[model samples]
Target: MIRTVVLDIGETLTRDDRYWASWGDWLGIPRHTLSALVGAVVVHGRDNADAIRLLRPDIDISAEYAAREAAGLGERLDETDLYEDVRPALAALRAAGVRVVIAGNQSARMGELLRALALPADLVVTSGEWGVAKPARAFFEHVLAVSECAAEATLYVGDHPVNDIHPARAAGLRTAHLRRGPWGHWWADDPAVRVAADWSINSLAELPDIVKAQE
Candidate 1:
């Protein structure tokens, strides 16, 4: 039985559609260009703050992104209330005796983001706070150790293949790739990794049944 559901924050819990789109729209650049710019920044060994600074020299772009993310802007763009399904899903999991924790990389704005979105989770673990990027065994093992959840009974739901699925699987945790965008097929087929999600639904509304079935 699944005793805990560990979630990834940025792409899985909160959609980046508006955040990315806003950045692209503000710079008058296509989305792909924005993606390329971000890639270049990462390639150049720039951290998140540095990447944002290089993107828009005129404004404190990193702070702006942080504020907007704290306020949950993506749902607004989709004409939906932010955290519409998040709170309810979390409550359901809690009701079903499943521990809910957020394992992600974020800056100091994490509390604000969860408050703005009204997401309830038992713990929040981040690479920035932990001083390590994920896809490393330490990331998964650390969270499991801290949360006191068995690696085999803890499931991680995320959007990224390598950073999320691969590492979590290696840690003996089940994985659910929340597929719902252009990057969905990035690892739809890979032998080194398994894509058989315990559940493969898009919206968070489908999570309750998914978790219950694991028991």
Candidate 2:
């Protein structure tokens, strides 16, 4: 009976179209160049961090993210930045007596940012807070422990097939692939990857129905 729904933040609940472009500007690279590099990384099945390291070997990722945050990169998020389906889906799930959690591979300020946006999540967890990132078994273990929910009774929804679906499925949690962001649209046709998810949804509007069906 899925008692908890764990959701990814970027490109899942929120649309961050300007995020990479802002990063490119900060790194002194052309936006298009950075975009192509990111696309290449996805195509080659490499981590996004690898692409940044390949482009700027001297760049310190942690420091860069710190600087970005200091400069207010992820600080303030407007309501329009969120997907139209996000609020409705969250409301429906909450009304159905399901615990909604927002968990993601983001900086420590992620929870604050979501709060600023007034996102409807019962709890928010981030990699920075947990000291581990996604695709890591320890992270999921932490989530399960914190939520106090059995793995089989949890559902994880995210856009990344590798980071979200595969790892969550391996952890015995049902996985939902949101087919809108880069990971979803780019890897949608890949049989090996897409097969990992229990559900593929283009919008969060479909999520409430899917969750009810799971029950």
Candidate 3:
């Protein structure tokens, strides 16, 4: 049985609109411009943060982030930022006795923001807090360590193939590629993603049935 469902944050559980928009505002650029740059960056297999660097090659993202926070323009998340299916799917999984964990590449404050929302989860953590991010073997090792279960029993889900499916699978965890976000859709049909992922799902709502099938 799939005992644990560990999920990524951005574009997996939540819509990234507010996030990119916030960055756009902070950078004093049109939201659409930043959005497009982010798309281009991701499409080229570059980091999403490269979008900002594309605009200002010398910018210190960490410093700018601190400046934003100092100016009261930091990250913020709420119910509206979440996809409609998040609560229902997570609740269903938890009700079915599946452990729900939210772990993703986000800031330390993001962990706080997610906790403030009180989502139905056993743990809500971020790379910023752990000092580790996805796509790294070490990150998956941490995931396995915290799962309280074997990798075979833990299912790691996320929208990004490189950061989620590939690395998690490498770590021996069952991987579910969520085809909900840009990265998901972009790589969904690729043979690499299909091969790396044990399952490719468009929504979290589909997860419960997949878990039940193992019964």
Candidate 4:
């Protein structure tokens, strides 16, 4: 039976548009400018940090940018009830005797996000906290160690197939893929990793059933 559920934040439990929209709202910068800059950096594979510095040369770019990002996250997420479906799903899992957890690539802002969304996770694990990235064995290993959960009794859920599902599966944990976001179409075609999940659900609303089925 699955006793632990580890969730990834971005795309799985949160939306990317919220971040961009919040950034525009908090920074007083034009949304289109931010979009163009993001496209240049991400789509064109340009140096993102350098591009941000050059684009807004007049501002103390790093501090100002981080503050805006944080403020935007706080505004859209922390202050607002962002993860409405998430809380109930987690509560249901908790009620069913499943341990709910957050395992992702968050920095120091994780606490703020959790408090803002009022997420009902029993544990919080992030790359910022572990000083490593997901899909790396150490990340999952560290989480398992801290939680004291056996690999077989734990399940890891995320939007990315490799980062969230595949590695966890390899590590002997159950896996779920939330398949409706930017990374959705990227790896869906890879035959080796195509159907790796123990279960797949499109929304957080379906997660409780998946967890209960295992239990």
Q: Which candidate is the best by lDDT?
A: 3
lDDT of every model, 2 decimals? 0.67, 0.83, 0.91, 0.69
The stretch of ten residues in a row with the least summed lDDT in candidate 3 is: 137-146
TM-score-better candidate, 2 vs 4: 2
| The 10-residue segment with the lowest total lDDT in model 1 | 73-82
TM-score of each model, in listed order: 0.69, 0.92, 0.98, 0.73
What tens-digit string does per-residue lDDT give for candidate 3 at 73-179? 88899999999999999999999999999999998999999999999999999999999888888888888888889999999999998899889999999999999
Relative to the unseen true structure, what is the Cα RMSD of model 2? 1.8
lDDT (C-alpha) at residue 92 in model 4: 89
Off by over 4 Å in 1: 25-83, 185-198
Candidate achieving higher TM-score, 2 or 3:
3
lDDT of 1 by residue, 1-215 (tens): 88888887766666665666677765566877676665565444354345445666777665666666676542242324244677788889888888888877655455344545445777766676776667789888877876567887888887666677778887888888766433334444444435545555566667778877777
- How good is model 1 by TM-score? 0.69
TM-score of predicted structure 2: 0.92
lDDT of 4 at 117: 57
Error of 3 at 184 (Å): 0.9
Q: Which stretches of candidate 3 lie above 4 Å from their native place?
A: none
**Model 3 score (lDDT):** 0.91
| Tens digits of per-residue lDDT for model 4, 97-201 | 888888786665664566555567787666877888777898888768755579888878787776778888887888777765555444445565456887767
Estimate, for each residue in 1-215, the C-alpha lDDT of model 2 and write its tens digit.
Answer: 88999998888988766777777888888988888888889888788877678789898988888788788664446787798999999999989888999988876776677777766778887887889999999989887876668998888999888888899899888888888777879877678767788888888888788878877
Error of 4 at 165 (Å): 1.9
